[model samples]
Target: MSRLTERLHRMLHADDRLDREMAAEWEEAPAGKPASLPPEEVNPDTPAEQPDWWISVPFRQGRGLRRLLVVLSVLLCVGIITVLVITAQYLPHFGQAGNPANNEVSRRYIENGMEETGAVNIVAGMILDYRAFDTLGESNVLFTAVCAVMLLLRVSADKRRSAAYQLELETDDRMYEPKNDLILRSIARLLIPCILLLGMYIILNGHLSPGGGFSGGAVMGAGLILMLNAYGFRRMERFFTIRLFRAVTVCALSFYALSKAYSFFTGANHLPSVITPGTPGMIFSAGLIPYLNISVGLVVCCTIYSLYTLFRKGDL
Candidate 1:
């Protein structure tokens, strides 16, 4: 019994000594040279398995498809260019006596346009009376362009939460339009009223003179741009805002459309129309030409200003 107890004590001491030696060796091991684990404890690393066959197949197929699409697109573009070139070859030369545009229509417009449309400007008489819808379409195109710009650039009011964002807005505004420029403000103060008056004159006299909705509207838009550059957005914002822009544009377009519809309905039914060609060479002449010019000018001014503000500060 004594010998058996002595053997058990020896075994316990040996196990303790073995653990201490192993711990010491592990601690002494150099950082670059880690002590190897026992063969049974060492995990045999497996190489990273290739992605699943299904996944790899799709990636390869997608690459091939992308190349094919690119080739097809190039081929399509070339085909379209070739067709256009061929078509251009058959077109009539400019200023040819036999040109289709040199027709009875031009003669009619030149001869009786003033008496029929009450517009001293023959071109205005023809366009406003004969092709007013086209003019409306052009105005709507400008409106659409501004709307698209707003969608892309305008910032949502709800998201302006942080000081950092407000600072960024101020920085951008300052960069584009200086807050305090005495020279610019002074020049604008003198020129702005004149420019505005000139624009109004052009629009009102569209039917009486060479100027019309498109030209007059462009002039007004330019004036607005000058005002924006001279005065800061805050001053402009007191009267012109996103809501005002929307309301004015919508109302003008609506009025123009309704006016045209009424004319079309009356003409188609051979009914007496309320709108008639008033006195030629007068401010109120050309039944709807002057009014249409006003509508177009409003649309143009709002669109131009909105585009500038939205782009500058992502707000309007």
Candidate 2:
């Protein structure tokens, strides 16, 4: 029994000594080297660490191209500035008394414009009658700019959040809400009708008064903006929808184009026109000028409103 007990003690001491030697060896191993794990524990499918994106081949190429483009753009701008400076230095001074603008063309327009266009406002006569083609080009430019903006910024309905969801989100966002001040609402309510009436008076009397289509249209647009600010977009949308905007804009442009075309054809051929230029200084005097003013007003009003709506919420 004593010999059996002694053998058991010897076995226990041998196991302890083996464990101590293994732990010492593990502690002494360099951290730079991985521990010698069992073959079955190794993972062969694990991926290696990748370098940063900035050091990749495609990224380096793109960076080089971007730098080249920036340099080229700078050079182009400098060249254009130099050319414009040289050209301007050789040109006539501002508002010179003897400039060609003070010539016979101006005299004829100033003296006979009322008789020719029946518009007491000479500036209105000049823009809508004498240089109607230029006004047409300007309107077309505005339309083109609007289309370009829509193309770039308008998102597809499929990609966008549902209208109901979007509306709820926007309603929660207090930034879009109208002020609830009683004084402001009262003032707006009182002034909005007067503003709209005044705008209409300006537009209708454009041929006789100092105000023309552009100015009257601007005032009308301001009135609309005021209404939106006071009452909010949902209320504004009740009367002015995207469909109404499209229809008005298209019809106004078409009418202006066809009317101007007929006028231009008759004048160029020196043919007597059936339409008579009414009595000067009268509200309904200008032959086609009043109609032109209405058309221009419609175009301008729609443009202003559309721009506001589109920029605010990326839609109209």
Candidate 1, residues 1-316: lDDT per residue as tens digits? 9976775564435435545666777888977777764333222362122211222232333444667998999999999999999999999999999988888997888898998889999888877778888888999999999989987887655446544456665667467656669999999999999998998899888888888777777788788889888887778888888889989999999999999999989988999999989988877888988898889888987888788778777888
Model 1 steric clash pairs: none
Model 2 lDDT tens row, 1-316: 9976775564435435444555676677786664552233234353221211112222333444767998999999999999999998987777999876678998899999999899999988999999988887877777777677777666446435454435544566556465766777889999989988888888899899888767777788888888877887788889898788778888988999999899888989999886578999988788999998988887787777777777766667
Clash totals in order: 0, 0
* Model 2 misplacement above 4 A: 1-102, 162-181
TM-score for each model: 0.67, 0.65
* CA shift of 185, model 1, Å: 1.6
Per-candidate Cα RMSD to the true structure, in Å, reads 20.7, 19.8
Candidate 2 TM-score over all chains jointly: 0.65
* CA lDDT scores, all candidates in order: 0.79, 0.76
What is the C-alpha local distance difference test score of candidate 1? 0.79
The most accurate candidate by lDDT is: 1
